[model samples]
Target: MALNFYGLDLIVASNIGTIKHVKYNSNPNKKPDIKQLQRIKELEKGQGITCMTWADAEQTKFIVGRKDRTVQTFNLITDEFSDTKSVDFGEGKLQSVSVFGESIFGAVESGVIKIWKSNTSDEHLLNTGGPIEKMKHCSYNSSIIATGGKENDLKLWDLEKRTTTFHAKNVPHDWLQLRVPIWVSDICFLPENNGNVVAVCSRYGAVRLYDARAQRRPVCNVDFKDQAGSCISLGHYDKHVIVGTGRGLLNLVDLRKKGKLSKSYKGAVGAITDVMSQKDANVVVSTSLDRHLRIHNAESKEIILKQYLTSKLTCFLLRTVDSFIKQEDGEITIKQEIDDSEIKDEDEPDQEYDEMFDNMEIIREGISSKIEKNIFLEDKTKDVTVSKKKMKSEAKKRKGNDTINDASISEDLIDSPKKAKLDKEEEKVNDEDIDQSIIKLLRSTEKLKRKLLSKNKKKKAKSLFYK
Candidate 1:
């Protein structure tokens, strides 16, 4: 994704062997217009794009790791894809690729990690371990990278020092005494934490937060409880994390609240494969195995836009910029919208099947009128009550003490079981009516005899001394 002087543009690399370019419409007056996304160009990659990262500081060139065990660079200026560069790490499948300053880092399924010097083709093999599925370079410090996977756990490496910086320790066993499995599917470094904090979601259904400087264990851990966490994306709020689950459930978790689930979004029909949030925490884009992409309002927990794509989307990046237009000499053209009266019914398209985003106007009154509703019941302090003597006198006039309702029963009496008076209508039972216990007295006697015999033998052996 490049958001330089050329305007904000997103380069979407899909697993379906296609790379699409979407440019943000640069119309200032149309800022609030829903058509912020415009398809620019699309090219067939022939091979599925596995991983990608910016290859240069200018954001003009981006390197894409492919399923063919090779990396290719796409130049935004030229709009051309470069020839594939071979990965020598046992030709394993590329799991992730990251660019750090003047070097390119890649992790493969064969447990090989390599970094190539940006200026030359000189490849340097770093440390190797279990298959890595996710590798993210720190946003603030490009020299730091975080890697995690099944059995691999979370580990941080510093390219500058050429050594492992942090080694994550597995979380302790749960209350059930079962070891928690480590299968980190997605990871994101906290942008506001100066690279000291990172959040990761595991296929084992947990969102864990780690503070590298604190301890090896996660500072906070939360489980989805219903479905495995498929992917995770950081929200606009520093402590907020948006996680997509295997059950198509989207949950917003707040780290400050002990990683409690703050809100949930519905509408996905299949397992959520990827999730990415716009700069606005309120807007979230998600892709699911249902072959659809959906944009949701995080606060409302409602889907605002949904589109059925041609193939399953493995990942996506949303690049947004400040109002796309650059002002000129005071004169501005305002595109007027067609009045509802002018649009004839016959000219209107069938919108029942239209899945495109619609421009709608929303008027916000105030926060109190919106999300902050009456969280508590009306106060009982204003309620009036009759005197105990008055109530008792009224009850007596109704029908003596028998008039008391079940709700008025004393707490002690309610707790105690009442003795039932057997009448002629009540059924009587004899000893035969009850079922006897199934335990056999003979079996118990035999078991007791065996235990006694063993105990006697052990006592005699102890008496004979330590031979």
Candidate 2:
């Protein structure tokens, strides 16, 4: 798939207990602008923002779930935390929160889900089970919600009926006859099926797609080796979903191909806590335990922008660029200036590598000495080649002259066999002498090379001693 998103605007929550509003421009020269939106700044991530979801259709307000089991409303226009009255969920981590109609649906990690109307007094309490990891409301049908967690299989709940509509059955036993355990970490409803088809990722590193009408078991289950998926988001393309793994791996999985991985993303160093795609855009925003926010273009699968928020992040919400709050009547709006520290100099080299090169010691010989040695070797080769060529030429001339003299001797002394034979023997002697001279020259070149090398080595040794 191609990542076609031009820009990114989103909210990220760090595990260090901070919520940052990030506005990113596609321009390379400009850095992503981050503004702290949290009223309370602390030194921990769990207690700040654990989960987030948009509260309204206009993407103005969103629901924030905290570690202390409290659900709060945050509006982008007002830029203030409202409806902050804490809930009494006893003692458990707040998993997720979503708005359905006038009532708000909040799920806790302790498996306690509280449902109550907005701007009301009494709230309805329902205990689904223990240790719920994720609870998400289907955008297609507001009343429908999905819940899954560790040891908790995927289940669909109808708010109006207050009944479980679909319960997913686990995969069959493995080859060793061992039953696979259930550990659903995140749930996402596919918009294509009108909330009938759903996708869920587990801590076991598997992404499964279940069709409520087709069967209880997952029709497509793709398992990633050595990487457990912590969160899942719908992909920009159809039948595709982006899965952020527990070991800092972000992968795009195709639902149509039995969970085949289409693309893998880079730049996350810590386990990804959440990955979300902007509606109607190919941009994907992910939060990780590494205390940074990264925006990826899903189509290109390249990390276009990265911002160090200095919080071990848990979750985030992707707000499109068009959804930015504008100046309303009687409302104050001022452009915030970004600090120099917030802008990352990506072109600068790492300090460690720079120091290493700067402190490096030069142990090799001087450059001039190296150059001289090279020149000597080059001259040595040329001299040997020239000598060999001269030797060959001289040998050929001797052989030609000897052949001519032999022919003249035979023609001049046709009757005297002994005389001609003597002449021929003398010519053979001359040829042998020429061959010996050539052999001597070749042998002398080898000796000369050995002497030159020995002299050079001695000079080098003397130079080292003097130094």
Candidate 3:
């Protein structure tokens, strides 16, 4: 799901074989009315939608990756879906999809990444060592993207050069000389830099920061021992990074402090799958495997909005009303400009004239309703109804007609005895034919039974001879 420029929330949720567009009531105090929560529209989906990314800056069009190994485009303005502008990845399941300006990036479970320079048939493929869990395009430099998963640690790739940019070297060995296994779950490019710095979270509960231009080894590493870090998102102004852990903890890491954990937000009961920061960064929204979507205050670390949806939600986008309004440059001005031609005079009779017309409209509507009611009454009176006496007369007439019909039937019955005898003879002939067919079937069954008995006797004789 993606947010539109109008600050209206749009999310695609699963419904049978299709996806539904759900718009939430953004008002915090007012509960969403159930009647208004009707499905906006349903788009046919092959398998389930795995990932989605905006296709345009206005967020009118978005590309969705499905488990069926295909990508589709959905247009919000027209409420239409186009699978024509798609790239198929054979049998691999899509792990993530990203839209970076004119290029589309998709990573799949087969360790292959597909890139489309434009929304056309032309595409390019890049192979990683193993399945990719997450791939994020660099916002600072559109030509760079970061991918990490499974056996593949964090690696930055330059789209223009089509080569690996930063290959993170492992941090040697532990004090006991045990080699750490590489399992990067998610990666994000730092926006503050010129696509040189990147951060990654791993299944080993480690968050590492690597600078592509500077070093092969991670510049900073922090491990939260309790649970694994599944996803990471940058905080406001890139001051801190919000890590969603497998234990449902939101850890705020300060970048200036060498990736130190500053604060923690709690309240989720299951593993956090995804987390997104609002434009202001004051509020962060997260989805968990426990079927809950939560919004938390960044400063106080308090839960602001916690809603439990019945289905397992993987992704969601939030848009606020302030994004639509232009920011004020300076303080409000007391003086304003007005045109004389557009001004209205207080002595004019426009208000009185409008009031008179409104009164006449109300009177006419009332008279039309009264006339309709009278016509309905007249129609009801015109309906014909029979009395009890007329009803009894009709019943008697029907009884007499039935007796006359019965007499006719008796006369016809008496006139056809010869035909009845002939029919009986024909029935007898049919019975004989049925008996003959049954006898033939019985004979065939007896012959089959005899052949089986002969075979069994022969087998017994052969067994005795062998003994």
Q: Each candidate: how many clashes?
A: 0, 9, 0
The better-scoring model by TM-score among 2 and 3 is: 2
Q: lDDT tens digits, residues 1-467, model 1?
A: 32333233455555655555543333332211121111213334446777777765545567888787778877654557764577777546788887766667788876678988756977778764777768778877778888888888998888877788888999988899999788888898888567889999998888999999899999999887768888888885778889999999888889884779888889998888778777533567787878677777766767666655545666665544322332248753333334334533331122312433354545566545213222211121112122334444553464344325434767775555551222111213321121121123334445655666686678778885744
Those runs of model 3 whose alpha carbons end farther than 4 Å from true positions after fitting are 1-27, 32-46, 84-87, 117-119, 279-281, 319-467
Candidate 1 residue runs with Cα over 4 Å from true position? 1-9, 23-46, 321-467
lDDT tens readout by residue for model 2, 1-467: 22223256677776646677776767888766667776342334346677788887667788887777667788887878778747676357777888878888788778888888767776877777657988888988888899988888998999888888999999999999999989998888888577899999988888999999999999999999888889898887788899999778889899996569999888888998988876455677888888778878877878877877654788777654343445558783543534445665442213434566799997656567557766876786677678767867876787688678667765656667887687678768866776776677668767866877897788878896756
Clash pairs, model 2 backbone: 1-299, 2-299, 3-299, 3-300, 15-45, 15-312, 16-44, 16-45, 291-311
Q: Please state the error at residue 216 of candidate 2 in Å.
A: 0.6
Q: 2 or 3, which is superior by lDDT? A: 2
Per-model TM-score, in order, reads 0.62, 0.67, 0.62
Candidate 2: Cα lDDT at 70: 69
**Model 3: lDDT of residue 400:** 75
Model 3 worst lDDT window (10 residues)? 32-41
